[model samples]
Target: MIGMLVTFTPRSGTFDRSTLEKIAGELRGPFDGMPGLRFKTFMVDEDGARARNFYVWEDEEKGRSFFTEELVEKVTGIYGAPPVIEYLDVVGFVDNSAG
Candidate 1:
């Protein structure tokens, strides 16, 4: 598996908790059952004025392919800032929900 972290640091007083929550709620349905996606989470640091998205994918290629230039531009427009995307090897994983 591979992990992708996308962080957004918009300017002060731009993006807020309510905006992040609304985005998350709207995107959750579309993201569910997405191809090659194992899991995804939207996180916000209200105090720090940042938002992040963590995604686990079946492979690095699938994860890398999902973050295209068009997607970045779209998200930048929505979030009011460009994101810093990072890919990482997933060394370990646990799913207690299966139990």
Candidate 2:
């Protein structure tokens, strides 16, 4: 498995908690069934200064394939800045709900 973290600081005065929540809500359904994605989580800082999207994919290739320029542009359009993307090799994970 591979994990990718895309983090960015939003432009000052461009976003608030409510706007962030609304954007996340709108994205939920589409992202829920993305191919090659094991799981994903969208997060924002408590004061709404920063945001991140964490994703676990079936493989590194799959993870890399999704973070395209168009996607980056979309994120930039919303947050007013490009994200800093970081990738990690997922050594392991513990899923409490798995049984």
Which candidate should be chosen as best, given lDDT against the real structure? 1
Error of 2 at 57 (Å): 0.4
Q: Give one digit per residue, the lDDT tens place, for model 2 in 53-88.
A: 899998779898887999989988876779999999
Report the lDDT tens digits of candidate 1 across residue range 35-66. Answer: 98999999988584789999999977889999
List ranges where model 2 is wrong by over 4 Å: 13-15
Instruction: Provide the RMSD of all predictions against the true structure, rounded to 1 decimal.
Output: 1.4, 1.8
Clashing pairs in 1: none
lDDT of 2: 0.83
Pairs with steric clashes in candidate 2 = none
